[model samples]
Target: MPLYQLNETFWFPPVTESLEDGLLAIGGDLQIPRLLNAYKNGIFPWYEGNTPLWWCPDPRFILFPDELKISKSMRSVFRKNIFDFSINNAFESVIQYCKITKRNGQDGTWITDSMQQAYIQLYREGWAHSAEAWQNEQLVGGLYGVKMGNVFFGESMFSLMSNTSKFAFISLVQQLKEEGIVLIDCQVYTEHLESLGARFISRNAFIELLSTNI
Candidate 1:
């Protein structure tokens, strides 16, 4: 499939046009309206160097709040109060940490400075949120994402301590569930998230859920 190139207008090609790797389009600015529209349509942006790449995969991975799993070890951590949890307590810090914290295979971060500022704007306007974990009055781990209607599009997470990011994720899910968020869009998959109950659903089903929820 041919990849689409976005222009100045705030629009995206039909998600069905995405390449096999789920890449849908490229070259769009991460403005608030454009970014929110992307998420509402089950699309998200990833960066390579300075280019913006948008994607929507065939089998979407997501977490249903009720399906969340907490292993015995993490449960013990919660009981021991190893980390303190808070919402929106440090949005910029969370994303900043995620940007700097190195992942195993990746040499650099997709969360560029522009992307960081864009989401920070989303957060200021109340569409984006963060969940943080702290220890000894210092930030240790956290995650950030955009939420609209009954769904949350999880962006990225970071941990300075063992399983701290997982703890933050679990903590955030519980809060979202209470507030009526039914779906948590992991967007892509990782074994860490799979263990926490993120599973794949068809693209058609994923779009259907987004339409229903948002």
Candidate 2:
């Protein structure tokens, strides 16, 4: 139950204490080995400012590829060819954009300088990837995350235009479907993601899936 410093790799008991809460060890460098191990163990880094906090939340939000909702409006948006999607095309740019973009109720950003550098490193090593949405050669929106085996751990996403991020996500999901991916780890709940068909699963269930899949 003790919260440790950011330099530690393992976490304490997850805040919720659920098996999925994954409050294991914490305070470690976000080096490739450490990050890979963390994801393999169902742990992920999520901290504000300079602290490199890691987490495993109970009742994690996830979206199975087949469960993705393609509402009529979204379908119409897709048909418009408003954006082009690519993978691992602009990983660092996507992360940097997500860090700088403003979110409702948030002035500063949780994606600190160190975190950006860390994820950039991950991308170089092929452990991380980005789904990019391009508008006439301009990067409008995208997302970045880690992929281990068949599971993708979503880190963050951003959009500069309406439905851009959604297009990137839908494209990523379709690609994952082609690659036989089964699960996407959303980490926490948000109505936006929920609206896209992401649903909650107990941390225990999440860990079990990670153990078996990743």
Candidate 3:
């Protein structure tokens, strides 16, 4: 199938037309309206190098707030209160950290300069949020994602210290649960996320969830 090329209008190709690898369209500007529309439809941008590629995977990875798992070891860490958690306090720093932090087997970063600037704009518009983990009065780890109503579409996370990202994630989940937000879209599969109670649902089901939640 031919990859769809986006025009100036805030629109996306049908998610069912995505490549087997989940790449659906390319060349769309990451404007606020486009980004929000993408997430609301279970589509998101992800690319390395220059081009902006959009995706909607067949088996969506997500974690319902009530399904978050905390291991005994992490429970112990939580008890220590060794980390401080903050929300939307350092959006720029969190994205910068995620941009630089190396991922296993991946060269360069998907979060390019334009992407960072766009998300910063999203934060300013109250559509993006960050969860920061601080230790010794310095930022250690955190995550950032776009929010549409109750649905949070997680983009990336980074940890300067072991288990710091996990701590921040757990904290975010608890707070979101309290706020009556249940669905968190992880977007893709990862062993790390699976261990934290993220599981796969059919793309059809995922789209249905987004329709109802956002």
Q: Best TM-score goes to which candidate?
A: 1
lDDT of 2: 0.83
**TM-score of each candidate structure, all chains considered together:** 0.99, 0.91, 0.98
Q: Model 2 — which ten-residue stretch has the worst lDDT? A: 11-20
Give the TM-score comparing model 1 with the true structure, all chains together. Answer: 0.99
Listing every candidate in turn, what is its Cα RMSD in Å to the true structure after a full C-alpha superposition? 0.7, 2.6, 0.8
The models' CA-based lDDT, in order, is: 0.95, 0.83, 0.92
Indicate which candidate wins on lDDT. Answer: 1
Q: Which stretches of candidate 2 lie over 4 Å from their true place?
A: 4-26
> Tens digit of lDDT per residue, candidate 3, span 1-214?
8899999999888899999988899997888899988998899998756889999999899999999999998999989998999999999999999999999988888999999999999999999999999998899999999888788889999999999999999999899889888799999998888888999999999999888888
Point out the worst 10-residue segment of candidate 1 by lDDT.
1-10
| Candidate 3 residue pairs in backbone clash | none
Local distance difference test, candidate 1: 0.95
Ranking by lDDT: 1, 3, 2
Tens digits of per-residue lDDT for model 2, 4-80: 44443433344454333545444667777777877887778876555566777776899999999877888998888
